[model samples]
Target chain A: MATLSLRDVRKSFAATQVLHGIELEVADGELVVIVGASGCGKSTLLRIVAGLETATSGQVVINNRDVTELEPADRDIAMVFQNYALYPHMSVFGNMAYGLKIRGMDKAEIERRVKAAAEILGIGPLLERKPKQLSGGQRQRVAMGRAIVREPALFLFDEPLSNLDAKLRVQMRAEIRRLQRRLGVTSLFVTHDQVEAMTLGDRLVVMNAGRAAQVAPPMEIFERPADTYVAGFIGSPAMNFIPAVLEDGGASAKLEDGSSIRFADGPRPGPAGRRLTLGLRPEHVEPTNGDGSIPLTVELIEPLGSETVVHGRAAGGMPIVTRLQGAFSGQSLSVHLSPKHLHVFDAETGRRLDS
Target chain B: MSSTALPAAVPMQAERDDALLRATRRRRVMSKIVAHGALILGVLIVAFPIWMTLVGSTHDAATIGRGDVPLLPGSHAIENYATAWNEGGGKSRTTPAALMLWNSLLMALLIAVGKITISILSAYAVVFFRFPLRMAAFWAIFITLMLPVEVRIIPTFQVIVDLSLGNTWAGLIIPLIASATATLLFRQFFLTIPDEFVEAAKIDGAGPLRFLKDVVLPLSLTNIAAMFVILFIYGWNQYLWPLLIINDRSMETIVVGLSKMIGSGDSQNEWNTIMATAVLALLPPVLVVALMQRWFVRGLTETEK
Candidate 1:
């Protein structure tokens, strides 16, 4: 395994630009997860690294050698697709052994690698079964096994668990992580699921509209989103946005009822009365006892085992979410912010004002 | 009593309920009668010509002229077969019916195999790889499906003649080797195959050829079966091109050779022998269709998505 680097990589399909000057590096045996909403160019960046797509005007250097024009086969990278594109005609064994056989590995060695990979996937009994006979989860495993047998320099996963059921997705997600850790190859994974990025990625690269918003570890991403887009795209129940204005001694958001809620932080960069946006995560919201707080009227309640998510509208017509610990039995509710948990962004530019 | 409560058994209730039930029954029975009538009409429309062909294939020239052949199989079937088989060729001026059948079948196999193999390779390249002029080449191949062979026949024929492949199987195989229908079908189907699977194979270090053969082609057995049936049927029934090129009677396909039997001879046109030869010639393609019938429909519909 060796380091891979992209220097000002850009890609465009005809006139439509998909990736814009992406600069990233993957050290030996590092696993980087690229996360974003749909059309964010995360998948395109991974495809660029795998040599499935060519950079429009940049260099893709692997181990200090420029391989910008190399085909996927020559790149020595393995990729697992979301749909698990297994050969429908081949049995599990054939599918797993295909890559090795192509690279001119001995037949006995091919069998050994296939059997070993199949065992790792716990699909030993599935060796003789064709792809159609296998379930979605099994086919995904076969796809992984096909990649595993080659032991390529890098492993690329393009949302490989999206087709699976919830339970199976979690299971396979863990299996993939474990397998990658065991193999320790330089890897790049693309996903739209922030949760997957948090749990599976060694470091997360949050992208939006063909640009990287932030590249940080999972906790750091949640703790310090580099911009408004990263803050909104990298969390669950997405952070609530309420229009606000900077005022004397604090940030002030005027409520629909003509009242105001004030949050104190370090000195503002922009001047007072400048319009800004306030962001609050659901988990930081607490049921308050007064009308002076961010007044909210409950609209919907979703109970998911450990917590109940209360959907409501904050004052000034902004949508709000408050997560109630365990199952809370109440319809009429109010929320108060913890003050320090608020995120402030420039209303026009949508840039985060705090680190 | 409430609005929904029924009255006790009385003359009024009994007769009124029975009449209401009778009306519903009559409507159901009328619908059944109409459905059966429509079914019979459809069956008769389709089965009439087939029944006529079967009866005519059995009767000799005398019964056919008299138009008095029964629904039962005739005893003259053996003699009719012998005549079609021999073609009364004391001098080899024309090939017999069996030779024509062989020629047609061989052409179908070459066409089917060649078209399918090329379709898989070209479709794989276009769908999964990034190369120069990738999509332009795809659309170029795809455009040929819309432009009928009639538009290109003259140039095609000239090319065949120039290549000295006239009246040969190579003539039949060369021009139509890249079937747009198969290529388009496989391309659409391959597109539906998850990109992840291709990624998986690539990570496995499988090259393009290995990917096509081991990863793609196997998943395509249904497509192959379907393509075989459709292309084989097309090649088997093709008449105009072979008829135009093959002046030698021995080189004609079953369709062309069968048509020749009708107008060329003074043997009173041997209606029975001609019909018998037609039926025999139609059997292999029919059998092939029968064998792959289920896959034909599924493959067409499945790949379309």
Candidate 2:
């Protein structure tokens, strides 16, 4: 187990900069997941930590040692690639024992480690089978067994479960979590899947455009996102942003359609008449029959088994989606945006504003 | 009403399906007959000359010299083969068939192995490394594919003479071992190996040579086997170059020595012994192909990667 510190990490390719000074600290035995959309440089960050790619400028410290100049092998880290990258010609046991053999480990020790890892992965009977003969899930287990046998200081996973089917992906995701916990290895997992990040990581680093937009526990990121990007990205059906302006000494927000909603938490620390963007999650919007409810012209309805997601537009052509508890067959309905769960952000900067 | 109608339609549908199945089976049997006929005719056409040589090798020298080549084996088979194996066939009778056969086998093996090793290494360097003038090096090798041995025969001979390699095995093999075609084939095969394998090898602490031995070499076994068969046949059939290089009768390959065994309008020539030597020269290449036929087909059709 080891702590990883990426200090002022910046990367640039030719003239276009990709990563713009990312700083993160991963504690020992913590599985920190770097989650983002494609082209957000989440994989690039993981590769940098793996020493597969050198940062344009920064320091990568693993267990208080500078590893920026070290080769991937010398850095004592193992990576599970997206495609599994198992040696097609070698048997499962050979694949797992290759690294230790290269290090001049004794034959008996290599066998013992490979056998133990195979037992952990429940692939003991498949030790002599080639990669092509194994199913996709079995190959994934072999890939993890290869990493586990190394017992490296850190584990780097580059979308390891992305190639599996949906069911297998979920199953392997849970298995990876359990295995990592048992091994207590410091790992940096990179993926474009927010659900994988939420379910797998001890802490999530929500990356946006090569920068860590928010770094916190999954629920913290879901409950109180650092910015509009993280707020919209983390939750399902995404948080909706309604253009509004502060009113009554920042005690309430007046939306564009001349509707005002008072803040239940308290008055935010902003000047009156300041432009503000009110954030409301889909699940937070309640279908109400009371006063002060905004009418949403229902455009589409998706009837999921447990809940229904209603897509509609509010006044002034602002699109809003609300998740209702049960099926509702209606042309239009009124939704009350609860002040208790409203996310306040500055219209100019997308940064969350505190009340 | 629908159930009553279905009973009447079922018999008619079954009759039509049965007729269709019979027609398909008839066509399949007719096509099989035609295919086997064509294959047998083609095999006979190709094997006729070899059959003639085999039959002629079993006859007495007088039978072949008189232009009465036997269609069936004669009682002189054992004697003719013994004479060919022990005594040389030409008028000088200096180089024995045993020595010539050994020379040819060694040369073919050397050339095949040398070509494969050099081509695989060069192709690996060209495909994997980021050296200066890398593409220039590859193109230069590719350009040599257009230049056959006949095209540069004079200069190549001069180089062999100046290096004092004439009459030596090096003169016969070295000039022919640098194969551009084999290099290109290997380069194409290496390109299909995914980048992830290299990365995984790197993470496993394997350097370039280790990776080549552990991963690249094993994956390339089929291709190597295929190339070996082709190069062995090409080496075994080398006539012009071996003729020009070897002045010593002891250094003569089977192909070169077999041609020398024939005399122009000489009634006293040992035609039976010459035919036996000819049959011996064809054996090694056929054996190589037969042994590696499975790998040869798989190498061309399927990629392990």
Candidate 3:
């Protein structure tokens, strides 16, 4: 019954509408991640779901019951914020038990639950410490512990790992995913980092500006982007876009410097003769001394040890990045783009074209 | 800026570099010294009057007037203090000055608590919630910051009179309950409170009042304590309003009553006792402020951050 659904959710601050109509659902024990850049209204959407903000015109149902107008306190949910937002004056124990104490929980019960949560978060030794005394990671753990003690129906995380350093963020991200899985709680995590959303979410929701670009499993989102924006945003190095024209029953991409690239797969009707946007993931394209390969002169080679990222441009100034395997160090390497991984988009609307 | 711009700008303006560098450096150093000197001078100007009150408290009236009286402690401080306390009030019945002291303390406490309660809650309402006329009410209250309390004194006085609080503690406390400055200060500090914190509390399922008490109140200790100190000092040191309102010497606050004693020194006022009572009059605020200074500056600075 703790499953939630948002129907036609919208928000506007005066003249500016920050969130368009957003429809989403979360079944019991599901983990959903909403990913978008800053000011894209991803955080606002999460805030609305958490009952911290009211949607301008929408129905938010929790457990199939309309909880749209309910006070946040009565909504039966818990949230962890990006900044942790720990009560500075309170010790860790006090912070964890504050909500229960307000709900008239028995003193011993509050203590026991707080202690248990502290143990779960590995903050038992630091319960007496204030937030100021703890490190960033510890503070994050305390924030989680405070949420855990509430034992609410759903958990809301608003970029909770964003404040941590890279190493800590990675480690905490895994820990949070593991914890969420173990607790089997319905959770909605909001983050601008697509990598985080892809890895941590049971279902990844890619948001662009204010709308959901695509919603799918990680592999599906990465492999089959719903649109040009989703293709560009979901991947780390981003999909390269090359302007193309369909000719002789095939697609041909024209580079700015007048060089042309031909894909082995023939072009379809709607996208032929018109300007076509060609998409290639960095990993799918490669350096080759073979035929049907796009020639590229490497301008820079970023050797990331495991996978080298080759940055180069075609004769037409269409910049491209090729993800290569091990030790390819040079500034003039040529890449062979695989037609199998190529994505076609209609140039007019940036929508992905089906093969 | 790009690295090329520096060399381009530097060489093309060769004539501008003539005395510009030296003059600017010299001006920087001169202004630095003057700034520090002014700061020290300003502190001295503020502290000297309080210091004088303390020194005057330790001596008889004639010694105080000697002008060359040493800054060090005098021998008769204890006796002078006792005399100031004993004769500072009235002719026997309940030693009305004690009653005055009690009355002033009660009024100040009531006013301080009332002003703080109304102001902090109002600020919270404006900051973290949304309703019709929210911004309108905020702007209306904010416009008061531009209008000095001095400008509204006549109307405020009339309002106090109409409420039948004339010459009473209620008269003193009521007009001071909703201070524009306190609300403004509280609003500033409250704005620094992150909305994320409120959301976190909300998702924890906390009601508005509970959120305020359990979350907002705890986070706001330093600010509230600092604001409390400031408002208390204002209430304690109030003079002109009390003088105009309270004709009863027995009900007069220390400032008003002290003014009366100084002005009506018809029997060669006991300078020793006057100085001592003056010292007593200043102690509470001075001690409270000194103790709370750390929190005050911290709160003020955080308001901007």
Candidate 4:
């Protein structure tokens, strides 16, 4: 059984702390994705797990073995680098077999493993060719094949699909998810792409400024981000945040322009007249044909074939985007935000206040 | 009426264009001739000494001693070559030209391979590993770039004597093996390798030596071949070092042997044999460079990239 755990993993470079007390655990066969913006220490955390980088303070345990002080080779882990670091001179089979050969595995066993990985990656025909001869997508597959041939205890992927074009990235991520499930190897993947994190991760670690802001399943992070950072970061076109003050015994928050939205699920853990931020995703804001909705001054409309995204300024001068079906064209339009879709965070600390 | 006017303007414009084209063609032809002339002149200027030596080697020793070196080859070609190959030409010496060539070849190959091996390892260590005083160690090696063998001849000779490597092939090859230029070049080439390769190798369970053999060395093939060419020529052309170290006649390299054949000024030197030995001395380096020229150019350009 393969499981990975990090206990208070911290990393510092010179005087700057790149990762601060990162605690995570991956169950057997689980794929945990650490997603963040660049320089948020997601890659550093993955590297620490891979044993390529050492944590300043903490323990990295793999399969109940403490591997914090071990070299990467002794950790029994495989990694797919962001650049798909295939040996340029070696053929695909050779690149896949190199790790096995280094461990002095039998020649037949090495060949068997390499062939199996090549077949799994659908690169059997291309195994005789050098990495330079392969296309970018093929090279990416070979990198995965190389990692797969090792059959290590854990798989660490450091933004492996970021180098591919967007269309290919989607296809590759699906393949990666399928492979991980089939192999039942615990893995930790890091990327700056939220879509990748959402679709591929069994659980997502939403990282912000060297700390995990929220750790939950994809829909949970989307529906209820732990803080304003995760609320603004996870969704496309981002979640709209507006200054608001909690009122009516924390059941409702009044926008700066006097419009009010109540928590649909339940009351938040805050007193009345408390200042907080209200967040609503672009997709959740529905356009209505009545005076009951807040007025949005239409500034621009982005037509994305099926749905149009309307960019406008809300009544409180806060710019917001709303996704609408078909097309809507007007200088001013009214959109309604449901109380169930509202997210409230402390104004001073940006921490979520509502359950 | 507009068509008629257009025809008149078109012919005049065509005539002007034709004149301009003709002028450009004429200038191009003239420039080509000038370029050819300049190139031929440069070739002749560069090739004159080699040509003179080639012609001089074919003449008889007596004829060369008479101070009548010919521009054209003489009838004594085979005789001079055979004499030079079988017997040393100086009055006091009798070592064969073949033995000198053999010594030179062994020394050059040893020095070349030795320098490359040392350089590649040192460069790998310097670039890939992070130890204490890494930059300091690198700078120490780099500073040796300015100090050639000529500058440190006395101390090197003394060290050779102390080590008791005097008059041995080891003395000849070892003193000139460590090359700061090769190390620096290899280090620079190694630096261009992406860090991902090392990281990937580590994750692949390849140790330092395995990584060097499986990844680093294979990637450095072109660089190694190119360095081999350069170091071979550099080793083959070593004159002063061999002369200082090799006291035994049998260990004397062709370059040193050739210099010995030409006695001090005013003596009746074996000019023909000396010229023949010179030709032999130049052959291997030229052949080495010619054979590896493709890899040399590609390696240099790829190393930079």
Candidate 5:
């Protein structure tokens, strides 16, 4: 196990800068997932840490050793690729033992490690089968076994489960978590799947446009996102943003329909009349018929077995989606945006504002 | 009531379906007959010459010289083959058919193996390495495809002579070994290998040479087998170049030797021994193609990667 520190990491290609000074610290035995949308450079960051790609400027320290100039082989890391990257001609045992053989390890030791890893992965009977003969999930297990046998200082996973079907993806994701926990290896996982990140990582690094928008535990990122991007990205149906202005000495926000809702928390530290964007998650919006509730003209309704999702527009044509616990058949309803779950952000900058 | 009604309606529909199925089966059988007929006709068309050569090889020289080539094997088969294998057939009878066959076999084996080795390495370098003028080097090799041996025969002959390789095995094999077609084929195959394999190999601590030996070579076995068959045939059938270069009777190849066995006056030629030698020359290439037939088809049609 080892700590990884990417200090002031920056990358540029030709004239376009892809990564603009990313700084991160991954503690030993911590599975830090770098999650983002496609083209956000999450894979690039993982490749840099794997020593597959060199950082244009900065230092990559693994276990307190600067290894920026080292080759991927000398860096002592293992990577599980998205496509499994198993040698098609070799058997499962050969695939797992390749790295050990390359390092000049004894034949008996290689066999022992491969056998142990195969046993742990529950693929003992498939040791002699080529990759083409195995199913997709079995191939994924072999890929993981290849990495496990190396016992490297760090493990790099580049969306290893992305090629599997949805059910297998979920199953393998948990297996990977359990295996990593048992091995106690420091790992950096990169993916464009927020759900995978949320369910698999000890801590999540939400990347936006090559920058770490927020770095925290999954629930913390869901509960208190650092910016509007993270807030909208993490939650299902996404958090809704209603354009408003700070009013009543920053104690309340006045919507465009001339309706005002006081903050349940303390007043935000902003001047009166300041433009603010109020964030409300779909699950947090309650359907109410009481006073001060905004009227919603329902446009669509999706009935998912245990819950219903209502899509509608509020006054001033602001689109809003709310998740209700039970089925509701209505052409129109009123939704109360709770102050306790509101996310306050500055309109000028998408940064979150604290009360 | 519904079950009783269903049986009554089912007979009419079932009869119609049965008629349709019979018609479909009739058409399929008719098509199979036509296909088999065409295939048999094609086989006869292609196999007639080889059959004629085989039948003629079993007859005495007097029967062939009189233009009465036998349709059936005669009792002289053993004698004709023994004469062809032991004694040379020509004006002076200096070079034995066995020696010519041995020379041709060596040349074909050398050329096929040398071409495959050089082309695979060149293709690997062109596809995997980032060197200066890599594309330029590839295009240079590709450009040679247009220049067949006949096109540059004079200059190539002069170079071989200048290098003092004339009438030598090197002169016969080296000029023909640098194959542009095989190199291009291998380059295309290598391009389909995903980048992830390279990255995984790197992470596994395999250097470039190790990666080539462990991964690239094993993956390329089918292509190599396929190329060996084609290159072997190409080398075996070489007539004009071998004739133009080798003046020594000892270095004469089977193709050139077989052609020389025929005289301008038909009566002076030993047609039985010549036919037996002709049959001998066709054996090695046929054996190679037969042995590697599976890999040859798979290499051309399917990609294991």
Candidate 6:
């Protein structure tokens, strides 16, 4: 396993700068996922690390060696592409053995490695079949097997499960995580799916507009995102933002409708009377009929078996969504906002405020 | 009570269904008859000339000379074939049909293979790699499609003579090998290969040449077979180029020999032998097409990548 580091990696295509000074480090045996919307430079960063694209200005160090100028093959890295990219004419065995063969490995060793990888992927029976004959999930497994056979210092995955159906994606996500843990190879996974990033990564680099908005563990990012962009991006159904003003000497946030939420954690890092943005996650809002609850005029209800998501507007016509554990149907509901889960950002800058 | 009521209503619906089925079956049979009739008529119309040639090959020359070409075969088939195979018709340029067939086979095989090799490599370089003036080079090659061999016959003939390649297989084949149509077809096919395959191969430690051998060539098998069939026919039927290049009677192609076998005024030509030689000329190309027809149709329609 190797430790991978990117130092001030910047990329440009003609006049457009796709990656603007990205810095990251993956400890040996760690999985770091780069996640963003399409065209947000996440894939560009992964390609730069894979040596498919040269950084405009930077250094890529892997296992204490600077590999910025090396070809992808010489860099000891293997990549699993989104489409699987299998040679259609070759059997599964051939696809996995191609790299080892090119490296001049003997037939016995190549066969051994391919057989072992196929077994691990539960695709031993499929090794004799062509890629076109396999189901989507099987092809995904073969793609993983091909990468695993290389036994490279690092593994690069570019949305490897994006083409599969939803249930299969979840299954493969766990399989990939388990496989990476067992192999203990440093890996960099890039995807546009936040849930995949959250579930699979040891740590995530949440990218926005060609820059890393936040880099932290998934739960840490979910609980305390560094900025408004990360706050809205990392969680499903997204975090809600409401215009507010800091009152009571930064101890509480007074929203535009005159309702206020007190910070139970402590005094936040903002001046009194300063305009701020208040953030709350959908799952953190509890439906309550008690005092100190915000009234929500319910507009829509989505029943998702175990959880019910309610969409509505609060006072001052600010849209809000609340995900509750049980089902509820009504014209209005009072929801209690936990002060511990409240996020505050400066109105102009959108940077998170710490208590 | 509901079951009894349902059984009574079912008989009426069954009557209607039976009527509809009979009408549909009648229409289907009528269409099938019309289709078979048209196909049989088409086969007869197309096969008439071949039938005439086959029948004439079995008759004596005197029968054909009197302009009473027989509708039935005579007992002269064996004699006519033997004469044509051993000593071709009307004697001015009697390269035996056997030697002519061998010469035609060699030329067609060489030309087809040579053109495919040149075209695939040129197309690969054009589509896969970026170089200075790449599009300019592509457009230049594309412009050659306008200049058929017939248009540049005199200059090409001069070049062949200057090189002193007359009557040689090199002279016969090389001038006809570089085809713009084949090159363009290959270039179009190569462009559709996904970029990811190239990147994956590069990561697998395969250089450009290795990738072409291991991946590109196998993927192009169908296309190559299809091109082989077409180019073989084109090369086999070539009349003007072979006529201009080969002065030696020993190297004359079957097409050229067949035409020369028809003698000028007042010379009696062996019509049966000429007809037999014509049959031999048509066999190799028909076999090539029949053998490769499946891949030819597939390659034209679908790209594996």
- How many angstroms is residue A191 displaced in model 3 relative to the true structure, after the best TM-score fit? 1.5
lDDT of 6 by residue, B128-153 (tens): 89899999989998999999889999
Task: Quote each prediction's TM-score.
Answer: 0.80, 0.91, 0.82, 0.95, 0.93, 0.93
lDDT tens digits by residue: candidate 3, B21-101:
889999999999999999999999998877776776676666765655557667788777666565572222122345556
Winner of 4 and 6 under lDDT: 6
Q: Deviation in angstroms for A213 in model 3?
A: 1.7
Misplaced by over 4 Å in model 4 are B1-18, B295-305
Candidate 1 segments exceeding 4 Å error: A240-280, A283-355, B1-74, B89-95, B107-208, B263-272, B294-305
lDDT, candidate 6, A111-168, per-residue tens: 9999999999999999999998899999999999999999999999999999999999
DockQ, candidate no. 6? 0.67
Q: How close is candidate 5 to the true structure, as a TM-score?
A: 0.93
Better of 4 and 5 by lDDT: 5
lDDT of 2 by residue, B1-305 (tens): 99999999999999999999999999999999999999999999999889988988899888988879678878888887888888878566748889998999999999999999999999999988889999999999999999888999999999999999999998889999999999999999999999889989989999999999999999999989989999999999998999999999988899999998887855478888888889988888889999899767876575555
Residue-level lDDT of model 4, residues B108-217, one tens digit each, is 89999999999999999999999999999999999998987789999999999999998898888887988899999999989999999899888778788988988888
Lowest-lDDT window of 10 residues in candidate 2 chain A? A263-272
Against the true structure, whose TM-score is highest?
4
lDDT (Cα, 0-100) at A255 in candidate 2: 85
For candidate 1, please provide the TM-score of chain A on its own: 0.93
On lDDT, the stronger of 1 and 2 is 2
Candidate 4 chain A has its poorest 10 consecutive residues by lDDT at A248-257
Q: What is the interface RMSD of each candidate, in Å?
A: 3.8, 0.8, 3.2, 2.4, 0.7, 1.0
Better-scoring candidate (TM-score), 1 or 2 = 2
Q: Deviation in angstroms for A53 in model 4? A: 0.9
lDDT value for candidate 2?
0.92
Score chain A of each prediction against the true chain A by TM-score and list the results. Answer: 0.93, 0.98, 0.94, 0.97, 0.98, 0.97
lDDT of each: 0.80, 0.92, 0.80, 0.88, 0.91, 0.92
